[model samples]
Target: MANTVNIKIDGIDVSVEAGKTVLDAAKKLNIHIPTLCYHEDLCVAGNCRVCVVEQEGVNNLVASCAIPAQKGMVIHTNSHKVRNARRHVVELLLSEHNADCTKCYKNTKCELQDLASEMVINEHMFMDLVPDKNYTTDKQSPSIIKDDSKCIRCQRCVRTCHDLQHVSALGVAYKGDHMKISTFFEHPMYEVVCTNCGQCVNRCPTGALIEKNYLDEVWDAIYDEDKHVIVQTAPATRIALGEDLGMESGSIVTGKMAASLRRLGFDSVLDTDFSADLTIMEEGTELLTRLKKALVDKDTSVKLPMFTSCSPGWVKFLEHTYPDYLDNLSTCKSPQQMFGALAKTYYAEKKGLDPDKIVCVSIMPCTAKKFEANRPEMRDSGYQDVDMGLTTRELAVMIKQAGIDFQELPDEKFDSLMGESSGAAVIFGATGGVMEAALRTAYEIVTGREVPFKNLNITAVRGMEGVREANIKLENVLPAWSFLEGVELKTAVAHGLTNAHQIMEAIHKGEANYHFVEVMGCPGGCIGGGGQPIPTTPEIRRKRAEAIYREDEGMAVRKSHENPEVQQIYREFLGEPLSDKSHWLLHTHYVKRKRV
Candidate 1:
């Protein structure tokens, strides 16, 4: 039998795990305990005393979120003392907080705002401690905005940055009254080593951190008659967009999303999955070439454990922190960037439209994509390939602004040529998906046989583990790849920068030996990206992953190499995978940067 602690919450006896918090015990009974700094993903932070509850024989109200539920402990969550203490705590936070809820980016979704309403705080009882319009807003980063004035100092962003991401780009600076979050030496965000992952933005309770929205720019492009606006939606966007439109979590709105984009006046509706498939071809081929050189020709210069570069945040993380391993990174651009390159080049030429007149917009489940699109090296097509990158939230706002009923929209299909994709492409939304997709193609190419898996599902690489590994022993290799045919291809997958750091450290210390590695910037891969739907708990991410795999299974073309559109792109313009044209248009290089 499991160790249990018997506690009485509001005179109702309950048994909870011994180490569980009082808040956790209360939640089992559906008791309401408001919190601002508390997040299911991060460690408990009792700075916000909103979850305080009255305990018998205790001198002061106990912070339910930080205190353990002990046996025979009597707790009253709604006692007069507890209510006043909680109300006072919120009022103090409100006093220093910029209360312009109407102008805040997180007006409705703000946890502090919601708690204030729940606590029935109509007016501030204390003097306003906020300086009149004298706060600093750090807008240097292309992906996120930081407004110190609206900050509630919850430290959720701090923990997320340091503990979850292992990128201590944010930390407490001053002490006492002047204490606040700050980057090293108060440098501008862009100048620091921040990866612009937006994990901090996702954890922030107020408008202090948010994605730098491109909604107005996209709106202007849509309204312009001269501009030929085209939008490409990412794989993760399809599964999570429904959440912002009042739909349930894990709702598959792929067709509805495509329809909504068309209704928003896009000249063409395309899929980023097309490029995701193309990434497999390019990246898989690159892996094969490296393996062949290392095994067949005995080349020592080729970097082993080739890393996937589909995640821009991971790319920037490596650039800033692990410059020595730059060569190990695959040269292929991310699916979003690849789509942008092709949209302006292949799609533009097919329709005889001038690339300059074509406004290429991308709907992504990542804020890092905004920064990725603006990189100087991204202008490979004689113009900025992707004109604008909108987050899932931003796209939802656009849909609402256009008054499109997203849930009621009819199912629609993406435009031809660049819109077709495969199941391998759809699964790119989840962690370890790229590794699985690459193996699906690489194994088939070597042996001339499909992967020996039921329903083409590589379950070995399909889970929520932070770091996962799989090995495939090549059998019955074709004559072209007949290097004795018993080589086991070792590969690994890691999501979230902290896990990525672990994998990188293992590789650097020579403790891990693998042929290829896949790293995603956020937890649960792109399904839990920094720009994904808010309140992104493990349960929500699992639901989204389930939806992604379901979409993958429903597809007729389950392999990247089977995509007819990818074949057509190579046949008509690109010639072949890693061809001169493909390299010029589809792949790019990364730069090493000094870590701040």
Candidate 2:
């Protein structure tokens, strides 16, 4: 049994774990304590001082978020003393803050704003201390924007970058009044080693950091009669988009999402999941080919344990932090880029439309997809493959701007040719999904049998663990792959860049040997992406993962190899997986980047 501490908050007594904080104890009793720098996904940051509570006999109000609960302790969450302190904290923050709430991207979602409203702060008690208008706003990055004046000096972004990601691209530069968050030497974000992952933005409580939205460009394309605007929705977007539109978290709104996009006047509604299935075929084939060369031909040059390349943030992370392992990354393009390449080439040819007239748009849960789309190597289809990338938040804005009742929109289906997908593709939104999907196809091709799991659910690789490892012993291999026929395929899955760094270090030290590895940049995979709905917690991420798995289990076709559209695409256009044509259109290489 664990030690428990008895505490009294506002008069009622409560029992909590010994090491639990006062804030944690208050939450169990349905008490509301507003916080600005406290995020469930991040460490305790007591900088904001907004969650201060009065402890009996204590000289000063204690920061409930940073202090531990004690036995027989009497605390007041909303006493006059506590309330005044919190009010003063908010007043000071507002005084220095650029309080243009209406024009701010995080207007209503801002934690500070919510606290001010809850505190009934009708007026500022201090003079405006905001910096001059000439203060720089960093907008050089294709994915995120940084405004210095709007920052609250909470250090949430700094902790997220340094602790969660192990990519210390952000840090505090000065002391006291001169203190501010900055990149190395205050360089442009794009010029630094930043991976463009939006985790910092997700945890930022204010408008200091936000995704660079492309809604205006998308609107222009929609209004231009000369352009054929088509949008592809990512698998993760379908499950999380509903949260932004006032629906329950993790609600599977696939049909409604497609319907809303159609109402937004897109020429055609496609699915990134379609290309997710295609990615499986290509990447799975690449894995098997490399395995065969290493085992049968005894080829020493083939890189084993190829890392999945679906996450642009992870791709850039490898380029900057671990360039020595670049050869281990899969050459296959992400599903979004693959869909973009096909939209202009195959889809355009099939519809008898000029490629230049088509504007390919993608709705993704990842902000890094915006940066990934603009890469010079993505223009394999003559023009820029994907013209615009919209985050889930941006899509909700469009839905509201069009005045279409999102919740009331009838559930609709995606258009044919590129809209169909399999359960394996749907699971790609969660951690370890890529590994499970590849194994489903790779095991079948090698053994000529369906995966031995009930309902094709690879439970081993599915969870919220930072890193997971599983081994499968292959048996009954066909004569073509008769390299002893008893090889055990080692696989690993890691989410969040910190866990990924551990895996890379293990590989470098020869402590871990694996045949395949999957890495998702954001924690909990795409469901908890930097561009997903805000206020994301471990519980919310778990619910989203459950929803994604339920979607997979409910699908008739659970394997990527069984998707008819993917099979048709290969038979009709690409010829075969990893073919010369497929390599040119679907595969690309990465370059090493200097780490600052």
Candidate 3:
């Protein structure tokens, strides 16, 4: 499709497009080139010279990642010299690294360990150098853990924080061998402008950055016979958790996952998609009311540019990064939080169990969820709605620890009352899913007719795309006030904090305007969250996202407004959406945190 350049690697001639890096050309030709710091999603960092390749007529070896291929270039990828260099680099990294893999959390699946194995490096020949024990560990962060001892100074985490998430809470400090990664003034992660999105942990080659796990709390609760431990799974957890069970990356094991959790001693298993449906019902009504008021009066206190609150990562980003636009965020708590709240109150009441005695736990593919569950505003049910939050990875570990046969477990449905959900609710695991769910119901109420697309699955706003826009026309409705006719509802969706920052900047500078906006702090939504399975890549994340949509496709109902349980909830407890009682139990306010 574009200009091509011929390059020879170890006597094999290959034709690749112009502007292609040597790494790309080499990969296409099946040439093995080791790389530790070079990631496809991040900028080329030649800091780790593991990808050094010998080229004919060149002064010396060149980094394949940073150097572009030229016409008729002779590249020697598997030379003896190149092998020795890569091995030296690996050995040096191991010398400084904490080689206690047996005692380390990353033990068997670490990238550095894999690289050493690939190079046939049995042991480090150099004298072992102890890491700086005095280096500060940023345990202050609720969702993230920073251990400098495991950091190899690859700068992947720093780049990911700045280039991808737009939250540069970390950077490479000092210089040379003494150089280390640290936050501003060596302050703890939470104190800095860290969003707790976990992008850094996802990109880390080692266990330098990790999630603050609550697995111990979950185990203690499960062991307690007096406590009724119930687990609610997020939409994103089913697909990604499969990775840890030795299943394919994108496998949808909803049934297997449920059975595994049941075998783990949980009293009952529930689904967060059920609460996602409830969110749509409440959020859609709120949008309709706000639109009605805005039509009557352009300046309404309800606030314009309503941002989706499904992603706790984005919520924290708004609170810390864009505090000036805090009013723009919707009052809706995420489905994870909403489900926990209901599980403790509504579900407990129906089951005739004491709310305090019931331990409501959530299995999510999100690190930000751990922080969100502990938020002061999240406990609308009088007690802490969610007692403990575990990631998909943690759930898999627990399943393994319990010695359950995950593959053979039969599929099962979630508990009733708080377990019923629709296709729209299931999509909440993906980016812009909440926006699409809210739109489906809002469109129905404003038009007083069924949505044209009963599927209500807007493919336009789906995927890993940084930004996507769509406009939906509304039909018959009563106008509360004077408004312009032929007006279209403009919306924008941003998947990562990098894109989130760009969109926010455009809005603030009057460069772009939108009625509704959806922002998910982690790339590819919860499926690619920081607390998701290890070695999360673009390809694997896509597989997990596909599983989410597949679940939506097989659902009997697709709209939140159509969920029978949601309707029953309104009929029994709350009279209607946005009611005073509903507001008191469901809605909560945000507090601006210090950016410093």
Q: Which runs in model 2 stand beyond 4 Å of their true positions?
A: 131-134
Superposed on all Cα atoms, the candidates' RMSDs to the truth, in angstroms, are 1.0, 1.0, 2.0
Clashes of 3: 2
| lDDT for each candidate structure | 0.92, 0.93, 0.83
Residues 431-550 of candidate 1: C-alpha lDDT, one tens digit per residue? 989988998999999999999889889999989999999988998999999983999889999999999999999999999999999999999999999898897899999999999999
- In angstroms, the error of model 3 at 302 is 3.1
lDDT winner, 2 or 3? 2
Which residue segments of model 1 deviate by more than 4 Å? none
Candidate 2 clashes between residue pairs 3 or more apart in a chain or in different chains:
none
Better of 1 and 3 by lDDT: 1
Error of 1 at 110 (Å): 0.7
Instruction: Write the residue-wise lDDT of candidate 3 on 1-596 in tens digits.
Output: 45999899889889889999989998998877878898877998899898999998987889999999998799998888888888888898888887778876677768898898787887578777864445455677668899887888889999998899888888888887779998888888878788888888878888788888788899999999899998999888887887898889888988898888888989988888888898888777776666666766565676778888888888888888788888888887788887878777778888898988999999988888888888888788888988888888789889988999888788987778878889888788888787787777776666665656646667778878899998886655535322423557888999989999999999999988788898888888888888888787889888888898898899889888889999998888778888876787777788787766
lDDT of 2: 0.93
Please, what is the TM-score per model?
Answer: 0.99, 0.99, 0.96
Q: Which ten residues in a row have the lowest lDDT in candidate 2?
A: 127-136
Candidate 3 displacement at residue 106 in angstroms: 1.3
